[model samples]
Target: MIAAAPASGPLWQQVLVALAVFAAALHVLHDRAPGLLRRLRLGLARRLLAGRAPLARLLGRWVAPPPPAGSGQTACGACQKAGCAPRPADHMRNTP
Candidate 1:
């Protein structure tokens, strides 16, 4: 039931415009609402693989589950610094 593009432009041009719009929308959604995107992806995968145990297992392998809580690590490497803090001896030696 999709409507055809106007005949004023070539089919290739119409396809390109549609693809550009789709890409832009995806980028905006990815930046503005990442959680929503993740949920949508999970929902889509579930719907696609509904009632299929083997397929579900394959999908699970492809999309690993999130790490357990209190793992002390994050996707971003902003965890505790190792040996970055200045010691009292260093401060004393540097003092004028």
Candidate 2:
């Protein structure tokens, strides 16, 4: 949306012209602000955290439910429920 400054002028002249135009525009918009910006921020935050139902539905899709209690009676029972093969205790015992 912005047009570049004229390229035919000297570099210092171009720099001064850009600074003057920026300062003049800033002076004009210094008033009549803040009302719309505050409302936009509130609307965006409301959209981000709209309801607990949406969050619960997303969690359900990504997470597998835990195995029922009292089902794992053996040493490697926990890994079996998680669908991974259990490692021998010798591998785990020497690490820590």
Tens digit per residue, CA lDDT, model 2, 15-48:
9999999887655644455444445445554554
Candidate 1 C-alpha lDDT tens digits along 1-96: 999766978889989999999999989988999787777777666665664688775785455435456876644453567655544587778545
Q: What TM-score fits each model?
A: 0.49, 0.28
Off by over 4 Å in 2: 1-6, 34-96
- Model 1's TM-score against the true structure: 0.49
Query: What lDDT is obtained when candidate 1 is compared to the true structure?
Result: 0.71
Q: Give candidate 1 regions above 4 Å deviation.
A: 1-6, 51-96
lDDT of each: 0.71, 0.58
Candidate 2 yields a Cα-based lDDT of 0.58
